[model samples]
Target: MSFFGELGNPHFRSFEGDIPDNREESIDVEGEGREVVPDATILYTAASFTDRGQVLVEPTGPVLGKAEDAPIDVVGITEGSRVLQINPQETGAEIVVIDIHHTTAQGEEREIAGTASITVGDDGVPTLGSSEPVEQLSTSIAIRGAGAQVAADDHIYLQYSLYEAETGELIDTTWPASPILLDLEGTMEGLQTGIAEAPVGSRLLIQIPAHQAQGTDDLIAIVDILAVHEDEDVDDDMESEPTSTSEPTELSSTEGE
Candidate 1:
C-alpha cells in the first residue's frame, strides 16, 4: 500500500472549506461512505473492503466535518496491511485520511487511504469487534426468555454469531442454518457463564474478554437459544453448527479449554 498524492485518493481528502452540504453524508454507527467531486480535484469515498482478513474498518467519512492532516502515529501493524494508528492529541481524533505519496517512473503516485471495511465471515474477521482489547466478559440480553432455565449441564439448542475481539468483525453465524446443540460440560467459562445466565428462548450477547479468550483475541458470541434439554435427546435429524463438519465455529474445539 504505497502513498498517493493524487487528488482522487478514494480513502481520504481535504476541502478548503466545508464539503458541499448537498454532497455530504453522515456516517451511521456502523460506518459511512460518500461520493464527492471537487471543482477540479474530484474525489469520491465511502465503501470498505477487508484488508488482511483479521479486521474490519467501518468507513466513517468522506466528509470528516473538517480538514486536518495531522499525522496519526502508527501504534501497531498486524500480520498484513492492517495498521493500528493513534493520535497523541486526543482532540485530533476527528478521522481523516493521510495521503502518502511517491511519484512513479511514469509520474503515477500510489496511496493507501487507511480506510478499511469487512463483510465478516472472512478468514477470521467477526461480525462484531471491540476495536480495542476486551478487558472483561460482558453480557447483554437482546431478547429475554420466560422458558425453562439453562442449567450448568444442560444440552442446549441455539443459534449464534461468533466474533473475534481483535478485528471486531463477524466470523461465524448460525442464522438461516441449523441451530447448534452444546453439551455445556466442558465449554469455556465465558461460554458457560454467559449461556447459563440466559434462558431458553432468549437472545444473549456475550463478550468474552481477552483474558478468557484462550490464545486468540476476545470472543464475542451472540446466542439465540431455541431449546434446552438434560441430555442430547434432540430429534435425530437435528444437525448442529458447533460440531458441523462443514464450517464449524472454532468454539467447538474449545470445549475443554
Candidate 2:
C-alpha cells in the first residue's frame, strides 16, 4: 500500500454559469477561462461598447485584490483602468502602512513610507540599505511594555518577519497566522541571544551578521515577543527528546503573497 496521499488527493471540479446575454462575441480577453482563487483579482480587455471591433479594459479583475495595485506601467501600459479601493468587508485584513527604505538592484535608492499599502513596493529586488556595515550582531527593542522578561529556557510564542539587511528583501513573516511556539534553548544561537531577556509586548529589530545566519548572507529580523508559558510534564518514553539545533524553517503570514 502506498503511504503518500497523492493518489487520494481530490481534483478541483467546475461548473458553468448561464450566459448573461444572447449577444455573442469572440472571447478574446487575456486570462480567458482562468480560475481566480479567493482574495484574488484579474484584469482583461473586451470589445468596446461603441467600437465593437476595438478593445478596451475593465481593468480590475472580477475577483478582489487580484493585482488591483499591480504596476502594469512597468510593462509600458499606462492607460489601463484600475480599482480605486478595496472594501475591508470583502478583503478581510486591515491594510497597514509602514516605512521602509531600500536600494534596488539597479542601485536606485527609494523610501516607501506614509499612506501607501504595505505591499506597495514589492516589485523590485530591494536590499535594506545601511550607511555603516554591520560589524557585529545587533538587537534593539523598539517597544517595551509592561510584562515579564523571557528566561533563557522559557517556552514562548513569537511573531516575526525576517528580511535581508543588505537587500531589504522580505524572507519570511508570521503575521495573520497563529504565533509560533519556540523553546529558547532550542533556537538558533543568534535568535536565542537576541530575545534572551526580552519582555512580552516587546518589538525588536535584530541584525545578525552572516556568520550566524541561515546562509553566508546577513539577516535582518523584526520580532514581536508574545506570550510565554512553562513546559508541561512528559512521560519517560518521550523524556529523552533531542534538542533541535536547526534554524527556524517554517514561514507563516496573513499577508498576500
Candidate 3:
C-alpha cells in the first residue's frame, strides 16, 4: 500500500470556456495565442461567459488604496486578446466634472481648489486637467440617485479614479474596466466619510487633504456608487473560495527572477 496526500493552496488559474490553460501562456487567439500577464497578481475571481465567448477575470494588484493588497476589478478579457496589466485599488470611485472650483495663493504659486475641466472620451473614460492644490477635504455630488442610501460600514461597489491634486495626473482608474468592492471599514478615513450617506447609482467628487491621504500629497478621487449593502454580500460576489473541480494556475512571489 502507498500513502498519498494532496495539498490545496489558493492561487490564480486561467481557463477558457470549460478547458483549462495548462500550457505556459498558451491561450490560442487566432494564429497568435494570448500571452500570460507578467505582473504578480492574485486572481480574485474567475467568471466564464461562454455564451458571449469571454472569460472574466478579476485580479488584485497594488495601486489605488491604503495598503499593498487592495480590491480592484478589471474588465474581462476576450479569447484572442491578452491581458497585459491588471491594477488594484482598495476603495474609490470615478467621474468627470468639477463644482465649487476655486484657488488660493500659496507663496508665489497659487493652488487650485477642486476646479478642473473633465472630459469623457469616446470610450466613456474621463480625463481631468490640473488644478490648484486643495488642503481641505471636500465632496460634491455630480449625479444623484434615487436608490438606497449608503450607510456607515456598508459594503459598496465602485468605479473610481485617482489623480494628482495639482498636476491632475492619472494615478489609477477603474473606468472601461470593472468596479471593485470595499467593506467601508477597509479604507481610508476620508473615503469613509466622503462616501457615507451617498445613495446608490450616484457619482461623487471627493478631495482629500494630505493629512487624510496616508500622508501623501493632497489627492482627488471620483467615485461612482454602483450598489450598496449592509451585510456580507461582497464576499458572495467575490467568489474567492477555491473549488476542487478546477485546477488553477499558481503565480507565486519569488525573489531573484
Candidate 4:
C-alpha cells in the first residue's frame, strides 16, 4: 500500500459550539471513524468568524484532563461553526467531538478537545524542511536499534520494549507499557544507549535506574529495534558516477580513409 493509504483518513468532531474555558469539560469518542474522547491528547486547528467576519485562526494541541473539559475546545464555539480543517487528512467526514473535562497522566486537569486523524488515503503527509532530517543509527550488529526522523515542532511517538536486568530477557508484563514521550535529551539517549554495547541481532536491554524509571524501581526495558526505515532524496550533484569531461570524438576522417 502507498504510505498515505497506510495512514488512513482524519476528521474532526466538536462537542458544542465553543472551546471550553476549563479542562473539566471534555468528551469521549468510540467505534470507527475519529472520535475525540475525554483525556485524550489532541492537537486542533480552529478557524472562527470574528465580529467583522474575517476568519480568526487559533491552533492548539492540548491533553485532556477532566469532565468539565469533556469536549475539548467546547468554548468560543457554537452551532453553525464552520469546519475549517481537520488532522490525519485521511478519515473523511466521520469525526466526532464531545464536551467534557478530564486529567492526563501528569494529573493536570484541563478542558479537552476532540479531533481524529487516521492514516487512510493519498501519499503520507509531507515532512518539510531540512532542519531536522530523519535521523537513524544502527547497532554494530544491526539487530537492536532505535532512531527517529523528526520535523521541526512535531510531536513524536516512541515505543520500545522493557526487559529484565540480569537474564537479558524481555519483561512484557508491566504498567505504562509501550512507547511514551521522550524529551530532546531522552531522544538522543535512545539513539545512543545500546548501539555500541549490544551485539548485532542480540536484543539490547537498558536498565532504567530507579530514580529515572518514573517511580518504578524494578522497571527495566529491552529495546529491540527490528528495523529502521527512512526516506531520503539524493541531489543530482551527489550521484555516484563522476561527470564526463568530453563527449566521444567523432570518428576521424583521416583514420577512416
Candidate 5:
C-alpha cells in the first residue's frame, strides 16, 4: 500500500506523515461542465484518484495519530465522488515499533523510550530485537517445556518466528496456527544445530549470523519445540510404500482418466 503526497496527482505523489485526526478531508465534486477524472485501472494509494475520476475529499486537519501517512490501497474509482472506506490488512502481529536509542552491537539490551511492554498471546507472534548485527550464533531459552531431551529420531512440532537480527523486523512466523513439523535430519542445518541439544518444550531465542541463516541475512528466532514423537508411523509408511523399479508396466490409453 502507498500514500499520496499531493492532491493534484493523487497516485503520482507520495504521501507521508500522520493522517488528520479530527476528520477525513472531503473535496467537492460536480458533474457539470467540469472535466471527469479518469477512473483508476491500477491500484491507487489511500484515498487518491485520477483526474478522470470525479472524486472529492473534505477539508480536515491532522487529527490522526502520530503516523502522518494513510495505510491503505485505493483500488476503485467512479464518476461520482463518494466516501471510500479503506481497510488496512493486518499482515503481522501487533508489535511495538521500537527505534534504537543509541548505536550498539548485537546482544546489547538497553532501555528504549516510547516502547511498551508486549505480551505475546497464545497463538500470537512474538517479537525480538538487537542493537546491531549478530557477530556469531547465540541462543537464549524463552520457555522450557516439560519433556525429554530432543533426539534425532524424534518428530518435532515447532512454532517459530524469524526476524532480521540487525533491524528486528519480523520476517516470518508459525504461530496462532499452522506449526512446522520436521525430523531433525530433514530440517535446516541452522535449526537442527540450534535445537539439537535442547529438550522438547524448550522455547529458544536464537541469534544466527548471515552464514547460518537461510537467506544469508542476520536472523533471530523464537522457537517453541511443541512436541517430539517417536515417528514410528513414518517408518511404517515408508516400509509399506512400493519402490520404483526398472521393470516397465503396461498402461491403457485411458489409465489416467
Candidate 6:
C-alpha cells in the first residue's frame, strides 16, 4: 500500500482513517501535540538569506569630536562613543573626520566639522565617500605702516625689509624685489600728491597696479615717508640777494686844503 493509503485506512492499525484522495489536503504538525491550523490553502514561504561576516561601523555625516568609533563588547554599546554600522560588502572602507578651523577676513575664528568616506575604485583610483565640494575663502591681506606721503608724478622710494607677518621672521634681506609704485594721476594721483606735500614722516595708503608686484597680482601698501629731501638751487640764489655795506665814506678834506 502507498504511504498515503496506509495513513488513512482504519482497519490497518497504523492507518486508522480513510485517506483523502485530494492531493491538496495535508496535515502540518509542529512541536509535540501542537498542530498549526490554517484558514486557507497553506503556502510555504521561503526567505532569501545572505551571509555577512562582521560589519564595522563608522561616522557617516559631519563629525564634531575627535573620537572616530565606539568599542564593541559582547553585551551592548558603550556610552559617549560613536558607532558606525557598515555593510559587509564595505569591509575595507576608510573613514575620515575633519574639523576645520579658519580665520575670516573680519578677524573671526570659524570652526566647522565634516566627514568623508574613502574607497578604491575598479581602475585603482581612490575616490571619496561623497563628492568633495569646493570652498571659497573671504580673506584680505593687511599691509601696515606708520605713515606715507606722495606727490603727482613724484617718485617715492620705499626702503624697508619684508618679513613674515605671522612669525616676524625676515623673508627678504632688502625690501620686496618690486617696490610699490603709485601713479598720482586722475582722482588717485591728486589725492596722493596732497598727502606727499603734507610733511615728513607721513603715513599713507597707496594702491598699486596688478603687474608691478613680483609675485602677487593685487596689493595695497602702507607707505611711511621716513625722510624728505627737496631740490634747491643754492648756488644761483647766493649772488642774487642784496648784501649790506659796512665801508667807510671818504670825506671831502680838500675844503680844508
Best by TM-score: 3
Candidate 2, residue 119: lDDT: 29
Q: What is the C-alpha lDDT of each candidate?
A: 0.41, 0.39, 0.42, 0.25, 0.39, 0.23
TM-scores for every candidate against the unseen true structure: 0.42, 0.41, 0.47, 0.27, 0.42, 0.20
Tens digits of lDDT, candidate 6, 1-257: 11111101111012223333322212211112111122111101111111221212211111111121211110121111122211122223211111111000111222222321223346322222322221211111122222323454453333222222223333332122222222333223213433355332333333323222222223232333322222322222111221111111110011222
Q: Measured by TM-score, how close is model 5 to the native structure? A: 0.42
**Model 3, span 130-164: residue lDDT tens:** 45577678877766655567886876666677777
lDDT of 2: 0.39
Off by over 4 Å in 3: 1-114, 230-257
RMSD of 4: 22.4
- Stretches > 4 Å off in candidate 6: 1-149, 155-158, 161-198, 205-216, 233-257
lDDT of 6 at 97: 14
lDDT for 245 (candidate 2): 16
Clashes of each: 14, 7, 9, 74, 31, 15
* lDDT tens per residue, model 4, 86-154: 222132221222211111111112221111111112421111111111122222221222223233223
Highest-scoring model, lDDT: 3
In the order shown, the candidates' Cα RMSDs to the true structure are 22.0, 19.4, 17.7, 22.4, 22.3, 41.2
- Please state the error at residue 133 of candidate 5 in Å: 2.6
The candidate with the higher TM-score, 1 or 6, is 1
Q: Which candidate, 5 or 6, would have the higher TM-score against the true structure?
A: 5
